[model samples]
Target: MSTPNHKAYWKTNLRYLAILLSIWFIVSYLFGIVFVEELNTIRVGGFKLGFWFAQQGSIYVFVILIFVYIRLMNKLDKKHNLDK
Candidate 1:
């Protein structure tokens, strides 16, 4: 009954992309790379948070992050009536 707005759709997608990218960059580069040593003082399973972030933590975070993104996008899709 209504027309689709492709540009608006892409713009919305781009906004989400930018937000996700920024978060990824900050977590991977800034916290993991720059603050590794300072963060190593705190321990997680015999690993400092920074060390964890550097070695095993980031991978785990990435896995969790994928689920988070899926969950978020599912919610967003429902909110926008875009679910298929």
Candidate 2:
């Protein structure tokens, strides 16, 4: 790939990382800690929402985000003609 396309590819990758990491941080830290009390007012499967996020939800989200990142990188690779 040309230099410009190479730079754009990495830039997009970094942006994706930033956005996904931010989501993980919010779900794992904010919902699990900072907003625990408010979230605890609600429940899921008999477990407090905040506690669930702290213990399980965040892990689920992280796994989902891994798939999302893989899909995204696949598309990005195709866009940058790097899929070969």
Best by TM-score: 2
lDDT of 1 at 72: 72
Over the stretch 1-84, how does candidate 1's per-residue lDDT look in tens digits? 444655555566777778777777777877799988889788877767886777766677677777877877787677677898
Residue pairs with backbone overlap in model 2: none
Cα displacement (Å) at residue 52, model 1: 0.4
RMSD of 2: 1.4
State in Å the error of residue 20, model 1. Answer: 1.6
TM-score of each: 0.71, 0.95
lDDT of 2 by residue, 1-84 (tens): 469888999999999999999999999999989999999999888999989998899999999999999999999999989999
| Model 2 alpha-carbon drift over 4 Å, by segment | none
**Candidate whose lDDT is highest:** 2
lDDT at residue 5 of model 2 (Cα atoms): 87
